[model samples]
Target: AGVSQEFDLSQCVREPIHLLGGVQSYGALVAARRGDAVVDTVSRNAAGVLGRAARDLLGRPVTELIGQEQWDRARESAEAVDVDVDAGADPAATDSGAVARQDGPASSGVLPMTLEGVDGPRLFDVTVHRTGDLLVLEFEPRAEGGPFVFQNFYPRVRRALQKLQGASDVTECCAAAVREIRALTGYDRVVAYRFDGRDGPGQVIAEDRSEGREPWLDLWFPATDIPPQARRLYARNWIRVIGDVDDRTAGLVPERRADTGEPLDLSASVLRTVSGYHLEYLRNIGVASSMSVSLLHEGELWGLIACHGDEPRRLSPEVRAACEFFGIALSLQLAAVAGREEADELARSRRSLASVLARLTSGASDDWMRPGSGLVELLDADGAVLLRGTETVEAGAPLPEALPGLLANLARRGAVGEVWSSDRLPEVLGLEPEEAEAQGVPAGLLLLPFNRDGDLLAWWRHERPAPREWAADPSRPVRTGPGGERLTPRGSAAVYRATVRGRSAAWSPAQRVVAAELWREVSGLLTRQVVALEARNT
Candidate 1:
């Protein structure tokens, strides 16, 4: 491993990647303060790209390089780049230099610009953005003084978007998006990866790869592959591209910002250099170039349109923008599909709840506790128990003799109801593997307290029978760092099959919501019954 001797796990999370003080070598960077609009920072290659040394470029008025008209346009456009998918410009409005040789609003100030270059005149696709008071510009040379005709790519992408919108489910949406991106970008591999949760591991839900490329579809990747810092950055930006991981990085002229005393934050820069650790990670997996289009939901990173190439490949500017737009559309579609599914599930649960509540006043006081009350099935629980003083109402399954004592202990620990939940009780009680089974109690359960007499309603779930498929050895995630000692999570494409014998299936959001709704309705009915009985006695 080429890891530094000082490397440690803590450093991995704490690495200030935004302050790397460099940009990718595929382009050059120039930045100036908004106050005086004088050049304050430039990438080392600024002279080669802008035909001026970084030293000479510094302290010069920005108007000396770019016209005042262009400066104002760039500023307005940078702010106008909305993260909202609906706010994106139509493909017809894309910059012609990168699209159809006609000028339009560059997705990211991507208009063609001419400047004296080290090799004479250079036509470049310029990108502009801001980080605090500094306005930054990146200059990437145009291949053959032009780009792949967006005119041709536009029709294909239009169809792709229509296909994506027509997808009936999340799996369908992700798979369709993956194929479109692969076809559009010509990457050797493309994957639509979904996170288990905001902070959990990721699974490759859909993948499209070139012939003979190792299949990564359905593989699991550890969350550690993306550190906390990297995740935060991904959530903020819509796109990132690595033209060549092996290319030398261009260092900034001044290492730190004079005002903030920190390396200028390039969190939004299109050409910001990547982390060394990440670069090494890519090398470990033999990836030469890569790109990622973030799939966001409600401002959080839900997943990514991840692409990779075995050789150094830089996509034309418009292609990158189109992929970004596709990601935005995909995110919205995926969320909508999931939202509709959840809405349908919730509607069914509500219908069940309505039927149960309708029988409340018509049936006997004890009738609501029967197996037909729909309470047992509302949360997918195998059984239900309502303990009132010394008496107990059981449905679907018989209660253990020690039920009262267990409920009392849980109430004292505040482990009942919202404080604690199903699938966590066994761990919280520190029950041994054999003890959980021998106790004849549900391995998982949910509960709601009724009153001070230790009265409550509880639902139980017994142990499940299936084993889980893990991407790696879950217990031993430690691995050797490439060339540093790193606490590598899951990187290798391998599988680990493991079973947890003592636990039942984890409760889902649908079950929780349904249970809560049922509790509210039933508790209200019980209160009304208490008042009616008192009136009759009086």
Candidate 2:
């Protein structure tokens, strides 16, 4: 019996396979037989340039496809030779200087040749070599004018989307998006901006800057920077791609036949260009090009995805399309997060109200008043003195010596449910004058209203540490030796100004959205807690 044969994929191909090879460099597979046929020819970007599927090249013949000129050159070359084929040149129109002379061996280095594909006759770099019995011709794709021939978008895009999906919150989502954008385009800075309120109070909430370079980190800009008109336009149009910021903004000449007579909304999209003001703004910040993706929720502009590069940049059309799709996915996540925050705020408010009611009915106890009480801690303040009838509370150092008689005079006048500080003795008490002692009041009276039974009720006060300007700026520079000294005010701009002067602020719409969401959630919680407590008591 004949030995059984098994198909071995590696054995079938002349060249070793590299399945996990990085696509950063260009490569091709070429196989062809002498005279009769070309066995197989394949390249990475077959569909993009050749306009044919690589699978079609399998088992194909050379004479049946490539023109006479390429076949003739392949036959003559004794060893591998690089041949330049220009499809743009007329085949019949040969140059008399070279082809006209019928140069010896056709100048082995770069013989002119042409190829024929399904789309029609094409051109390529054909390397011819003699393999004893059958002549082999290797074909490499010719570079084209569009996107760089070597870019492998599939894996890059997949990785980007995977990263975006892993983000948990809006901040992380925007941050992830910025990081991906930087990786995709090699830009220097990326930012996220969101509207603060419906009235256009937006700000930057996140930024991803190049390492070791001083980026405008944690800086804030006024809403006027994006103007009402810009905000309204962004709300309507979900995204805008600015190919070249410094490029002229003239509309595509003759108008887009598909969009003719529509009075194009320039703000919506300037296609291939950007507005002068926007360009100048980007330039001021040292960015030469930018692309922004609008994040929207409930028909409102939630924020923006900004990609900024130091030099003029033009992203591949495919990349732009991919980014747009990714932006839409991000918008959905933003909406979901916003909805969750709203629900959380409502729940927090209800809880706070319940707590307030419980405290007001039985009177607030020492347990709640002990934390962060400012100077009130020194007075050994009791619960009644902290929560007594009052809209707010204030406390500071002990009162002056004459204040005891003054407080007595005011209390005798029936100043209902009010507390006042005093340091003087009251003679009407019928005791020898000593300190105007009142509950561990700490050399001062802990004022609280006496209930109907003249028992201590509630008091209110708030005191905090003295403000300091030494560490104010988040970007502030510090000089340290044996004794450290602050170099500037604690301001992001001041810190930036000290380092890099007059640079445009680097912020964006996505950051604002994430921050707005955060601020809204925090403020909503505080409001709910306070309102809930008030609601219960009232």
Candidate 3:
């Protein structure tokens, strides 16, 4: 029943995964109004998990199920989490991985409670959070146990933090992270997947896996693998788990809420049932169970600590929380490493810039276009150009003769005296494919017009021949499910090799700053030249 027609990848992005009206059967959910504490919604399996009738659950105070004191503590814990998030508190500030006695709360918003049931009492670790106007409490029964302790995972995570913080570079940091995650989770494989940029393709930079497993250590995955909607959820939630892809989901009672006529928004629910397409995708990849711990930086979904198990595996809520804590610490360490690298790069750039400036200042003439000015190598561009009035002078590789006309059109669009750039220069200039190729057009352009009259310094980058390796053919990203019920993006294991064209390496923020600084110097030189010429004429 696989799709025979061209696949529409947009369907994946449009799926409202968070509004799915079910929860994983391993846990049961109960929701009550935050203002009134009146029970309004519960998963159909809530009665089975709580050992009470579903009818008896609704229209009662939430305190009836959870004792009044635990209820207050849950609310207080949720509010504390909210405050921490709002203030952007350091992830290390709260150690959710701390071990506790079986009778005590494992972490904030997670506590053990024995609820009265039809037959004696059942102990569960209750996870509490708020979604919209509702207070949601999800209950997962504890494994038959003696004294439960988070000792195993807590120490591993603590060790992981030490390694992450001590690492001097991103490569070392990521390698240490994956190694610790694999050791802590016992997954067949663990990898750190880093996105190229916002919503861009990702690559598995580092991996720790079983000897028998195929290496995905450096494989690249298209952004479509995790669609935009999924990215939004990952940015909001720190952890997501799928115990068994084959298990049927427990339906939510009434499905949609009576007030909004919409399914429960489980954006923050740890046990929320996931997209069927995602489940099928995991199965295709030979993963029976999986977990993703979001790696965030400055509130953005930067990457993920992804784990895969060959057989169905379920982790206790405590284990998952500990993993989440490790992810947070790793993110902070990543930021520190990146900041240090950027600072070093800036230091080097300043040294080179000062050298270039000294040469320009010592010159007998004001013209910085001279060979020793280093303008050609300043931005690592393939070529550089100086354009004034109607004249154009170039160095290094040749630029399109029509480039001057293109710049005039750009100025007409009001880019005068402003910095402008594009990695896909031909496309931005509105040239057709044939036209661009025939003209041997550069793929990137950066312009700094010193004044509104359109006199400018320009840099161009030639089309870089880059061959990419995608997990699958990006054009065939989806196919109808076996039963033609859903669209899935996974099926083939063969890597797709493609040569990407019409684009150049992107300019970084530091390069842009350098461009601006250069512009100020250029403007001063031009002003002095004009004043000297006028003085001689007078």
Q: Candidates' TM-scores?
A: 0.83, 0.40, 0.87
| Overall local distance difference test of candidate 2 | 0.44
What is every candidate's alpha-carbon RMSD to the true fold? 7.4, 26.4, 6.3
Best by lDDT: 3
Tens-place lDDT per residue, model 1, 81-100, is: 64422222123423211111
129-167, model 3: which lDDT tens digit per residue? 776667788888886552236785677778778888889
**How many clashes in each candidate?**
5, 28, 0
lDDT of 3: 0.75
By summed lDDT, the worst window of 10 consecutive residues in model 1 runs over 96-105
For model 2, residues 1-538, the per-residue Cα lDDT tens digits are: 1123322322212211111111111223333555566543343334444454555654576455565666766676644442211211222523221111111211122233455556776655543444323343434354355332335666887788788778777888888887887777676777787665553334456777777545544454444345444554455444555555565432221122122242211221213233344555566556777778777776666778777777766555455555665677778877776667666655654444344334333533332233343223323332223223342223333334343334334444333343333332232333233332332122223343343323222221222112212112323222323333222222243332212111112222332232223323333444466699999999
How does candidate 2 fare on TM-score?
0.40
